[model samples]
Target chain A: MINNQFLVFVKKEFAHVLRDRKTLLVLFGLPVMQILIFGFALTNEVKNASIVVLDQAKDHQSQRLIGRIGASRYFDIEGAVDDEEAIEQNLRSGKVKMALVIPSGFSYDLAHRNKAGLRIIADASDPNTANTLSNYLSSIIMDEQAELNANVPVPYTIIPEMRMLYNPQLKGVHNFVPGVMALVLMLVCVMMTAISIVREKETGTMEILLVSPFKPLLVILSKAVPYLLLSLVNVGTILLLSVFVLDLPVNGSILLLLAESTMFIITCLSIGLFISVKAQSQQTAMLISLMGMMLPTILFSGFMFPIENMPKPLQAITNIVPSRWYYIIVKSIMIKGLGFQAIWKETAILAGMAVFLTLVSLKNFKIRLE
Target chain B: METVIKTHELTKRYGDFIAANAISLEVYKGEIFGFLGANGAGKTTAMRMLCGLSTPSSGSAEIAGYDIYRQTEQVKKNIGYMSQKFSLYEDLTVMENIRFFGGIYGLGSKDIRLKGQALIKQLGLESEEKKLVGSLPLGWKQKLAFSVAILHSPKIVFLDEPTGGVDPLTRRQFWDLIYEAADRGITIFVTTHYMDEAEYCGRLSIMVDGNVKALDTPSALKEQYHATSMDDVFYELARGAKRSE
Candidate 1:
């Protein structure tokens, strides 16, 4: 009999979710939109950045270097500049992101001194692009140098070989897919569940529910079940987008990834329950969910900002943010393609949070209308 | 008369303020017990306590032979509640609302179907059964809410200003439903601001400053206060109330 009641309750919750157009849009549309935006539009990888070249050497080596820079996808040689003043003018006007200066030493220096000098002046106004462009130029020059000395044996020289393990091409989508999954699931689970529960309070239906013979714990559980299912759907949507649309493959076990995602979803639902219990109105619940959960998930998840770079206290604060752990677990399973052994600690933390939050919220959930 | 609700020294305190002070009362089965009070005279608080929707600070009460504190679930099973705010899901269709509520109350599917059909027919809402309750007129919504409240045939129904914003005609029709329910042995415990509606009760309790100042039949209270109507008697008791909403 109780099972029948629970089914009926869950059915009603689904009806509530399906009947509201705005909620339907939010439940499905938001995840898809976020995935497309993060995967394609808001990428960190710099491409086709225009630069001005100052080739004073007017020699074969200098022209070849310029040709390599132009041929590479990272940069576009907008046009040649006569002097430093023209380079400065192009950079100041934001026409070019970088200025490549090959000093007049030409091929003569490399033949005599076995070394060549090159200068790169990048617009530092946007520091990330400046740093990345300079690094790309340095690597290209080093590649040319290595090729030139390929035939001649240089004695007693140690050359370090660097390889990026997971993402060879350094695709931005690989990093952001996990972050977006964490963000979308957190927002959909926490905000939607909190608002749905608090909406009952606002419309005064919670009083009727409280007075009914149904258990208060069941009341909370039934409210969360639909959102839990919906969040899983969201996870699928994100993964599908990442694999097919973003062309980022899932490296680890699909079942394990889903299991970890379910754990995180439960954690978010528990937080939503906590917010619903404490909030008197839907507006308050929404504000608290957005400000409290969303901000921390975005900032502390270490997907957008590296946790190591943050101050010590801020890093400590990130420890309690469930998404921070979820983010790490997702990257491990999805990007790094690791097994459970690699992510057991993060999984344990997420499970602990889910248990702790569920207990606390259920304890705080008032059986009375108070 | 069987006492379905009995309370003694029931109090609810919020730190320094007492929302419902120590009070004592008994309500007989099938009585239209009018719980009258001023704006903040604790009418809703007392009713909430009786319905097991609020815990009392220090109190002992028996609702349908179940302890209010220990067997709250039993107390809930025996009572129906409708608040001043419209508590039905406005987004749900009328039939859907009936089925949902009936299901939660542990009613059988057959019983829900029968009750839902009879309710829709009785309310003349057969055509609007599939329409969202949000589109219904206020009077129809109130009537529907009341009918849904008693669908399980509980021992008592606690209505906290159930007819607050309806017109007089709708309110009268609403009272008719109450009378019909009372005739069927469902005790009606209602709080209202309408003095005219107060006269419809079988017995009345007038609360002033969290205390039941008078408890008697309407005419008897009028005679004792030497007043012409329930309105004057209510004013005589509630005029000095220091609390205002």
Candidate 2:
């Protein structure tokens, strides 16, 4: 008999889902957009370089050298500066990635000694780009000289050995498909759960659930079950796409990956339930979920940026983001192929968070009823 | 008499204010008792306490001989309540709403389906079984809500202004259903603002500012106040209560 009520409630839940086209579009459209945007827009690969030139020698020869440097497809001419001080300030302020310092007598010396010196001061704050810059700069110079030497004699050949490490091909899908999956799961699990609970409260339907013969704990469980099921499907869809379309391998055990994702999704769901209990209105629920969960997850969960590079206090705060631990588990299993032995610590942390949040909300529900 | 509901000075206090003033009420096995009061007159609060949905500050209520304090589950099982808001899962259909209440009341699956079918036919909602309750007209929704409220056939059914927004014709139809339920020996304790509805009650209590102003049959209240109808008695009692303040 209770199955009928369950069926009725589930039907109503799905009805609200279908009737609200905008929310439905957001629920499905958002995940697709996140996958595509993260896989393409917020990719791990580097594309265009902005080069600022600080040329003290403004002669026609120096001008010709600058023109050749800008002609290369690798670097775009960001701007030109007069003195080294301006270049230093721009680099320090992160306005430009690489600054070319052409010496005052660059053309005059190249004519006599067949050797011209230039300093490429790249911002090393971003280590990958900084390392790439020196190699790219020398190649650009060599390429220009090679072009000059095509018709005449150039003193020596500069055979630049340029190699990329870690991700040599710079495949866009390598980091991003997994990142998109993490982002979509994080949003769907947390925001959807929180908003659904708050929607019940705002619409005065939650009171009916509370007054029912079911225990408050059962009520919470029932509320969470359908969402958990939906997220599993979403996780499956994401996995299928990444494997089929992007051709990424399931390097880790698929079982371990699914199990870890289920745990993390529950953790996110619990956090959302906690937020719903704290908020009184749908707007408050949404704002708290966005500002409290989404922003921190994007910033500190290693989904968009590296946590290790952040300041100390921020690193400390990142520990509290549930997405941070979940991100670690997903990345380690999906990308690194690390097994449970290495990922268990993060799994335990997420488990603790899920239990803590669910228990606390349950306590609040009973206490309020009392 | 086997009391279906009994309250001893059942009261609820909302910080310095008495929501349900110290007053006692009793209901017999098959009586249809009406509770009348103005808006925010503590009728709904008192009903909520009796249904074990709200806790009284200093007094106690027993539903079907079960003390509300210690045996809430038993009280919940033996009593049914329909809130003034016509509370139901609006996104669900008529069949779905009936099925939900029946299931929560612990009916078996076969019985739930059987009773649901019978109810849809009885309420003239057979054709509207698949229609969402939110999309249905208000009168149809009200009738369906009351049907679901009694789907479990509890010992006592509490209705809090169930016919408030419904039209007069629908209200008459609803009262006919209540009479039939009372005839079948299901005690009905209902609250209403309409004076004409109060006239249909075997007995009633009038509340004003959290206190019972009068308790008797409608004719008795009218005769005592030297008035023509329940409306006059209500106004007279209210004015008297106001003067006492």
Error of 2 at B49 (Å): 1.7
Candidate 2 lDDT over residue span A67-163, tens digit each: 9878876678888988878877877776677788777777677676666777777766555465546556776787777765677565633333333
lDDT for A71 (candidate 1): 91
Give the per-residue lDDT of model 2 (tens digit) for B128-219: 99988999988888888778878888888888888978889999999998998899788999999899999999889999888888888888
How far does residue A149 in candidate 1 sit from its true spot (Å)?
A: 34
Two-chain DockQ for each candidate model:
0.56, 0.24
List TM-score per model, in order: 0.81, 0.76
Q: Write the per-residue lDDT of candidate 1 for residues B131-232, one digit (tens) a residue.
A: 999999999999999999999999999999999998999999999999999999999999999999999999999988888899999999999999999999
Evaluate residue B5 in candidate 2 and report its C-alpha lDDT on the 0 to 100 scale: 81
| Model 2: docking quality category | acceptable
